[model samples]
Target: MTNKPTALPARPHFSSGPCAKRPGWTPQQLATESLGRSHRSKLGKARLQHAITLTREILGVPDTHRIAIVPASDTGAYEMAMWTMLGARPVTALAWESFGEGWVTDAVKQLKLNPTVITAPYGELPDLAAIDFGHDVLFTANGTTSGVRVPDYDWVPEAREGLTFADATSAVFAQPVDWAKCDVLTYSWQKVLGGEGGHGMLILGPRAVERLESYTSAWPLPKIFRLVAKGKLTEGVFAGETINTPSMLAVEDYIDALEWAQSIGGLTALMARADANAAALDAWVRRTPWVEHLAKNAASRSNTSVCLVLPGLAEDKVKAIVSLLEKEKAAYDIGAYRDAPPGLRIWCGATVDTADVLALTGWLDWAYAQVTAA
Candidate 1:
């Protein structure tokens, strides 16, 4: 029988969303001046604007693109883009996971756009070459539930008649994005940044803005989804005036995460941290006989939200392993997404330390042995 591991991960927060906070993060570290103040106040607006500026600086977003804070986290940011801009052209929706499926539902059932739907099963990607760029294309940059990601943006054409909307909630900081190929990209503070939830960031390229000015959706947009007023982009929203009230505390937490990214040498460094953490986990997965990556193509594997499967194991056994780990406090929130295949999902974002990931591997081995032996 394998022995229980003596060592445990120092910090066992492995939830994919609202992921582990940045190393050395604490509530006291957040700026409080903006708290308890009206979001429209001078201090509040300045802080909100500063968050947008820091995001551009750290992410290297070009001046040609506009960024804004939106409500309801990533889902809100993405749906806002869809409800406003999708009906302008033929639309193509791609799905490889639950979130992607949600967008497909929105396109087909909600908006009644009758979009062309392309899908691959979990752990796989739809054929990139098969997509028609003449139509508006929507895809998730990373399959957070399935551990699959597009290796790069080279497949997306530089010249296309349609807009490309990427739900990049899990990919923004950890993965490299070719901004020129994307017209609309949305993410939330709670994903790779490990900040508080309930807020999202929307990035609009020149093309997306042009669409907003020229095309109007057939459906009446909700007040929160309005990005354009009087046939022009709402410039103030991009400049820190939000359509709805925002949580100043959450805003402060996001700013803190962004500043941490800047202090650690910016985007390149953030990507490196995530890469190292994933590499460590991958190494263990390779040596372990029972487990394998859910994503078969290594190039398509996600560095954040890495999912694994125990071949031949029953789903109940997989759940048992997850329960054991949590009971021992060796790991927390590492179970696979409910809709995903039964297995494990460990977050390897920039905020996670490689040493902690390595330590968790030992406990995984112990947990596997305990669960399978019964």
Candidate 2:
């Protein structure tokens, strides 16, 4: 490890998930007095319900839609949506990254849903054509692996007969989501809110709820994954109550994250923080010749998962620089995904400070010189 001065900030954790909480966040916000109560009890219900309401208000979700905390992380919520809502009609799956690819595989090979797969390269997006309103649409709002995102909902045709299912796992806080454009949306706490992962948030529009009530799944629904009971949509589940027992501590942490977000001026402020961080990185990348952005278009780039590619560095050399940064405590967990080419993936979300991003970029320049010189 490089011998760097170790004066720590008030808080500095940069893990991809379970990220550092917002600045000034404290554990004291949690209701330690209610720790031992049953989640199904009145106290737990009230606490959890409040969280659900706050989440809706913060995200600008409509009153007609219901939000639920489901079992597992983002993955489970996605699978539940797929299993429940897919195969009702022909499906179009849009993929630009690993998660999107995974969902496509599940639709074709696993569930045997008759689906048309549209794919794009790491830096490019597929043609928005061939999207028929008669079929369900599956897409990832933000491509976490490549750090590319759809510029807006303009790609989605206005007159659509089928539902739009979007996996906005990493895009929820940093990017603006037009809830009207989607019938089903799934996200986890770990990404933007920096809360510990265990539960996934699933939001359902009126159309999606109607489908859940009317459509019969060819496959049996597990108790945890089922959204309907007695042929009726369980709208109450979205308000923090889960199918199974949830970790109260985790719930408390999520509540704290939400409260912190509100305290810091809510979504507008959070988005500004993300924009500032991305802009800081963008300026650094423009000045540095040895490195460049992975995504070809600046407008399509992500503010949360910001990826970059080295121009001439070998795969091993790129890995070396990432290792050096982590060892020196200049950055943490900045390596590119294994499937992606050699580069870096910086989490430039709301939880990160712009100044910290600048500091890390400066270290990147120094680290590159030392490794290349050797």
**Cα distance off (Å), candidate 1, residue 174:** 0.4
Candidate 1, after superposition: displacement of residue 112 in Å?
0.7
C-alpha RMSD by candidate, in order:
0.7, 2.2
TM-score of each: 0.99, 0.95
On the 0 to 100 scale, the lDDT of residue 335 in model 2 is 85
Q: Model 2: per-residue lDDT, tens digit, 232-336?
A: 987668766778898888888888888888888888988999999899999999998999999989889999888999988988888898888777777778888
Instruction: Give residue 165's error in model 2 in angstroms.
Output: 0.7
TM-score of 1: 0.99
Instruction: Please estimate how well model 1 matches the true structure, expressed as its whole-model Cα lDDT.
Output: 0.95
The residue pairs that clash in candidate 2, if any, are 67-238, 68-238
Ten-residue region with minimum lDDT total, candidate 2: 1-10
Tens-place lDDT digits, model 1, residues 1-374: 88888888989888998899999999988899888999999999999999999999999899999999999999999999999999989999999999999999999999999999999999999999999999999999999999999999998999999999999999999999899998999999999989999998999999999999999999999999999989999999999999999999999999999999999999999999999999999999999999999999999999999999999999999999989999999889988999999999999999999999999999999999998888
